[model samples]
Target chain A: MADSPIVGYADALFSVAEAEGNLSAVEDELFGFAQTFQANEELRSTLADASVPVARRLQLIEDLLDGKASATTASLISMVVSAGRANDLPAIVDAFVDRSAGSRNKAVATVRSAIDLTGEQRQRLTEAIKTSTGKEVEVKVVIDPSVLGGAITEIGDDIIDGSVRRRLNQLRESFR
Target chain B: MVASLVSLMSIVAFAGPASASGESVGSCVAEKFEESLHHHGESDHVTSDDIHHVAHDEAVQDELEACLEAPSPILPELTEIIWGGAAFLILLVIMVKKGFPAVKGAMDARSEKIRADLDAAEQAKTDAQTVQSDYEAQLADAKTESARIIEEARVTADQLRTDLSAQAEASIAEMREKAAADVEAQKAQAIADLRAEVSGIALGAAERVVQSSLDADAQARLIDAYIDEVTGSNG
Candidate 1:
């Protein structure tokens, strides 16, 4: 967790979703929404611009995800955005996923790529993360185009960087 | 002179007959003889005796006339003139004895008093000259002292003004520098604040773009590729 308050918010949202019997859908929706917010610059700008009041930001979230997500999931995100935590949404969601995985003695495998992963690939990647780290893992995929191409993975303290963006940055630094 | 001629005329007019003393005696004697003749007539009535008596009287009168007619027989008196001359000589001797010495002594005292007065006037003139000279010396010194004081005051005033001007210029320069520095500091601070605000906006916008690209479908695809790579590597 990045901060205690952020962790506290994550725990609180997790308990609410669990109690509603919609924990799986809530977590999945929240994780996917957080990734979308992190990836789209214009969308993030609209959501986080102080000129757009918090009320407006909340309304925007409702218009997009009101019926698409569970009431608890939508409400939790609306609460976070309305309470002025749009900038911290990705951190809060990541913390929640980590907490969820930790409940089952599993590590979180955060993956970034330009395209969505298939179910077989997710299964294989999870087993591979378990085999490499010698621990059980729950894979969470985040789509990012700034990855440009290829993929980057974060498992606990380890980072596997295979993204085209990293290669380009290395090339730039070398020229300098 | 006329009073003396009148007295001479009056003396000639009142003078007696030249045979007055004898005539007067002879007359008285004839008067006595006549008385006797009258007594004799009464006794004898005698006429020839009376005629003889008258003849004798005429002879005695002629003798008396001869004596009175002499002019050089009498002289004037001299005893009263001698007594007046002796009284005038005694008065002249009293004047010479006392009056001359007293007049001479008075003239000498008056001359000595005039000489002392002239000497006192000369001493007074000298004292006046010395007092005038001392006053002139003091007045000259005062004039010189006043001139020196005025000169010194003028110099001091000029220097004071010069020093004051320099101090004012220095103070003005210092204040100007301080004001310029303050303006520069304020300008730098405003730029720093704008930079921070701009950087925040840029970072937020970048984050939003990255998030927008990482949709669920894209995230799933990236997960699939990462899984293939990881498993393939292990295999």
Candidate 2:
């Protein structure tokens, strides 16, 4: 697998999951790996550097995941890095997520927040989104410090922004 | 003295006639002759024969004297006048022939020389003017050539400067374009990273929603509804 072989690997992974009857679990794990890769700049740079040995990069992935991920998920990540596809980790994960969502008949809704939401808040927000858009959503949230307060969500091409960052930007623009 | 002797001879001839008529012929002859002699002595020796001779010589002597002393009828004074006039006429002819021709020739030669000198001067002046004009023309040509060369140099310098400025501007524009491309690539990489991070959070959030919001039966029903929605929309 090449450095930018995201789609190819994603297709292979999706097929493998379909064959093994564990698409959801693999998709979820891949999604979490993508998040960890994005948030950690040092990990991304290390994995992407061609000078680092393939064995060392694979070991780094194993050590990082340890007991947090399934055997299948760890093996899959290791295989990708060993093949020098570390830079494509996020794209592969996104593809896997999309594939899994498609198989289960659902839309991927990416959401961001300054803090983790309670159970009631998630339920009400999901119901509200479902009622407003008339579509089944698989909601995912990212805790971002840059959000400051409030939440912003995206479903496919649609966006729902209700955040302190956006309010402050508007205020700054008005002052200018 | 000649005239007194002639007068004495005339008296004796007269006295001889008187005495001859009065005496015998012989005695008369002797006495008359003696008397003539005495009278001649008294008259400065005048002889009777000398008186006859005087009377006979008178006409011939007068004729001879006339021939000797008539003042030379062909006048030498007239000959001298004629000779002097002829000499003066010859001198005048010689002077006219020699002096006048020489003077005329000298004047003619002088006038010819003057005319030739003037002609030579005119020719020299014309040659000098020609030479001066030629020099002036060459000078003008040189000035024009210098001006042309200066103009060409100025044009060449301006072209070089323009070319240099254009090259510099082109280089700056190329550098700016490369910088912009690099920036765009970096921006794209950053956005992709942000998107991936947010997707992970969304996954975790979804899991939490599943775990907290619904029991087994509700989950099954929610799953069924999602499946129905997706299939209906896609179909």
Candidate 3:
């Protein structure tokens, strides 16, 4: 399994959560962390930089998930960082989320927002999407300020675009 | 002369049948003609006595009457007719057997030659007609062959024109296609360069504007409010 590092790491994290009876919490926390890691390229580069000591990278991951996530989630993330797989964190988190959703028979909806959504907003948006699509969805929101004012949602091949970025592109095209 | 006249008169008055009359008749006409000549010789002189004159008048009167209405001096007899008829028949027979046959043969030969000449003329006319018809047919064939050759030349010229036109059209089409492809490639290159430049400027400006407009707290509150509105409306 380790021959394919992306899948191997995802599987190991998935097993740890399942064994600890906290699969859902681990999936949510990993999804948030992967989003943050992608958003801040400086932080991601520093953590994934090979010049930094392996122990320092592990300590950084522990400090990141100290109070925000469950013990199993923290341990699994720390283990991936310790294994020197920080560069593959986003891909590994996606693999893990896909595996978790498939097991639960729910669809993955990746949402790009200007900031993190509140718990109440998350619940309502999920229920609203379920009602509209007639399928249970695990919504993963990423803070992307480039989207300007509105959120953009992608579910498989479908895109629900409500972003100022798209508007601006349309305006640029008209100018051309 | 008087005595001879009396004698000739007596013979003429009493001539016999052809048994002896041919000689007598011949001698009688000759003797009478001679005796009459002798009387004219004697009576040609004017009379000296009245009785002589009267006698001469009577003789002249008698001669005149004899000359006017006297009988034939020599009568035609049977023996003479038979001999004449026989001679005529002999002459006719000679003409019929020899002269007539020769003339008829010459006429037949002439007629046959004429007929042969007419046949030769007819053959000459037929041959002339055949020669004329053959000449006419040959002339007509020459005309038809000339016309066909001209038509073939025209057709070949037209086909050559068509082939040249088609080739020109194909060349023009190829040139137009190449020109269109070049234009399309240039347009695509321009579009790609413009897109790269525009996207970089737009992303930078947009990132700054959005970041300045909303902090994490404001973004979260706005998102929660939007979500709340959407859920409440649906319910």
Candidate 4:
């Protein structure tokens, strides 16, 4: 059967990394790169500016992800920047992550927190969500200070919100 | 010379003969000579002689000197005074008769003309003043008419505005009343529909209870009792 376009890209990248024997490392690095690109507006605008030379934009991607990502992941990001598809980078990465999760028969669980969780806290929260949902979940944690405190988790259409901002909004609504 | 010759001939004849015809001729010649001498002499000399001849010729010459020594009226001098006085009186009469009347007539005519002109000017001025007053009155009337029209228009506009506003308010009130009536009717209809549904459910429940509890004969008896009770009440 023919795979989806996003699945094809993810399979190609995964096969290449597996051939190099660095699939897990490349996947982790690409996940962080996708989150960074999603969070930074200025970086996104610079990469998406049509007027900026493609070569210069590639260089910026290299400078941002060179040391922090696997060589294969860095090269893949540069390739995407050079192709003038920087705006689609986050979508492509998200699709790739989803494809990778589907291959393992796990649901992609996106978790946003106001601060970084400790290793023990992350493992406990992941296990608790897996137990509650009765499914294996690939937890993708995004540290977002705008959440104020606590965490908000989304597994498909199910949202488990435990943030201070959400509590305050509910309190304000009850008064109104 | 003729008169002296006549006189000398008469004197010689009288002295020489006394004949009847000679004496008569001599007297006649003497009378003719005296008449001629009277004609020849000047009047002044004759007057002196008349005075002096009664006395003597030498005495008349003395009287003539005395008369010259005294003041006498000369003819030329008297004639000049008389003519000058007559000419002055004539000139005075001519001025009164002709020149004075002509001057008076001209003055009267000029004064009459001036009076007529002044009368005409006064009449023209009065006419002009009347025209000006008429124009002013017309202007005032026009202004008053405009003011009255403007006031009437303003009153009409205000009345129209008031009528429109009243109509709008009444229409809005009517709309509100219609909406309230419609809402009340809908509520009543909903209540009626709910009551009909509840009545259906109640009837179904009552039928189930009766069918489960009663047999066929007991149902027929209950129906007959219900009919008899209704008929007895009607009777």
Candidate 5:
């Protein structure tokens, strides 16, 4: 993972977010934007398309992250997009989150839910993950409606799934 | 009998006077008899009875002498007998010289002809018998050939029947195997299709149920429940 070009981009984004003195907020905003970019095929295609003008792609990134992300997060995403690395945006953001979590001496955990979790729930989930892993963990929650209900937490290679969608899939497999 | 003798004697007396120039023996004998009878009549001057008896005796003696001098009535002339014997001998010699040989030659030729005809007929019979024997042998050979051909045909027919039976059996076996495999395949495919359809229906119904009951409170409850479950399990 560290040998990938995504690591270099993540490092560049990490350096810029750390220098801006808001690494955690930029990392969280970038992670949310990366999820949106992963889910939106049109946005990813537009950003990665070579025939599109670089200025236009940068403008589109600016427009999507306008008021929602900090200037450092927007600028880092715009730099990656302008560099024709939009298709690798999710990987770059994930690497950036991993680096940020590593600096705090914590493992990164990606959590998926059908609905937005309350602050208390996120805190409880982070503590639950840290207890389950026996290590400090930074939890990143992605609102994925396909989760249907409950949540699925991915910590390193481990997955703790408590999803209605997973239950339905298991039921479908049993029928076969 | 006496009249025929006298007619025969008269015929002889007339034939003798015709042949010699002299008086016939029968007339001479009658003159003598008459002379004697006149003498006797003369001598008998004593009685008439004695003279008649003497005349009859003299007449019988003169007739007897005349018969003695006549030729024998049953005997042929010597020259006629000799000539008849000569003629018979000549005819017998001619028959022996020419007719016997001719008759014998004709009989011998007829016998030879008969014998030659018999030989030709015997040869013809032998040839006919030989031809019949050859025909019988040929017929026997033909029968054997016919039997051999019939046997060969029977064997060929048997082999062909056996081969056809085997082929038919093989074909039937292959068809049966293929049919069994097809049935198994169809059965398996049907089972798979049923499983897929039932799974799809059950899954669709479960999704609907889950979607219907999932309100905001339920979602929060599920999240809290997941955190509690994970923390409890880990703890």
Candidate 6:
């Protein structure tokens, strides 16, 4: 998660976001974009394909995040893509988010859900995780249909798998 | 006259003093009587007185005695000896001319026959020895050939046994490997079947529960319940 090149890129992105005075917004948007990049096989492959030409890859990044992300977030992703680091987009973004959370003395928890969490549900879930893990927590939600229902949360190496998918898998394993 | 002559000879023979030795006197008188008989035929018969006068002649009696007293000659007569020698020479000439060649010819033929028989016997002995040599050589060759055949048979039997043993071992190994493969395949198929059944049953039941019970209100309640459970466990 914290290889040297990935940390260096993350530190540079964090410094840029902080200098722009929109660290929180850029970090959140970048985290969500990274999740999208990881989820979409075509987007991940195209962005990482060195044969696609840097100009074309940059244009594809701009088109994908046009109005969906802040200008600062789009520019930072384009910078990473143009620099041929698009293949490490998820890792760099994760490192940046972790660094950002650490500055505020909190841990980052990536949560996968079948449905989008309400604002109240997010606050409650965050509070519950902070209590359970004994750390100030920042929750990042990834809408994943494969979760089936409920949620699966990953905080560092620990995973809290509460999804119906996990329950069904356990039932399958019992027969063996 | 002949009867008177014979009577007168008888009386004169008895009256002679020399007539006491009858063998000599009788032989002389018989000779004279045969002469007188031959000289005087039956036509000239003489009386008994005339026969007595002739018989009393002393000169005739002396002459007969003198003839009987003379010694005989030792040699045969020349004419008889000459004839006997001539006959013997002729017989010897015939034996030399005819008998000797025939005897020699017969003896030569007998000797030739005996020599021929000995040669034949010798030739037969040599032929018998040659036949014996050939038979011995053939017997030796037959023994060598039989020994060679037996060796070949032994080698062939060993090779056949080795080949059969190897084939049997290979067959056993192949069977064992095939059996193991079959067991493994069955185990894998059974596991897959069990997994599919469990997945169908568990997923079907879960899907039904989620679809029927997971309304907006129920979803909210479940989320709230999970939050409460986490906080309570940690606190």
Positional deviation of B225 in candidate 1, in angstroms?
7.3
Model 6 error, position A11 (Å)? 0.4
Off by over 4 Å in 2: A1-4, A19-22, A41-71, A81-84, A123-136, A154-161, A170-176, B1-235
Q: Write model 3 residue lDDT over B1-235, tens digit each, in one string.
A: 3334544554454444334634444455455444554565566453345334444565654654444453455856566566556545655666677768888999999998999998999899999999999999999999999999999999999999999999999999999999999999989888977886787687667666766877667676666655655455436
- Reference-based lDDT, residue B85, model 3: 63
Docking quality class, candidate 4: incorrect
DockQ of 6: 0.29
* Candidate achieving the largest lDDT: 5
In the range A52-171, model 1's lDDT, one tens digit per residue, is 887878788888886788778889998887777878889899888888878778878888876666787777878877666677888787876677666788987889887757755565
lDDT of 6 at A52: 94
Task: After the best TM-score superposition of candidate 6, give how far the Cα of residue B49 lies from its true spot, in angstroms.
Answer: 64
Give per-residue CA lDDT, model 4, range A19-135, as digits (tens): 877766777788888889888999999999989998888888878876787788888777777767687777777767776777788878787765566565556566676666676
Docking class for candidate 1: incorrect
Model 5 C-alpha lDDT per residue in residues A5-94, reported as the tens digit of each score: 989999999998898899989988998998899999898889999999999999998898899999888889889988888888888988
Q: Write the per-residue lDDT of candidate 3 for residues A12-101, one digit (tens) a residue.
A: 888888888889888989898898898888879988888999888878877877888887877787787777788888899998997789
* lDDT, candidate 5, B85-148, per-residue tens: 6555655676677768888999999999999999999999999999999999999999999999
Question: DockQ winner among the candidates?
Answer: 5
Total backbone collisions for each predicted model = 26, 3, 0, 0, 0, 0
Model 3: number of clashes? 0
Native interface contacts kept by each candidate, as a fraction = 0.35, 0.00, 0.26, 0.00, 0.87, 0.46
Which residue pairs clash within candidate 5?
Answer: none
Clashing pairs for model 4 are none
What's the distance in Å from true for residue B189, model 6?
Answer: 3.7
Candidate 3's C-alpha lDDT? 0.75
Positional deviation of residue A79's Cα in model 1 after best superposition, in angstroms:
1.6
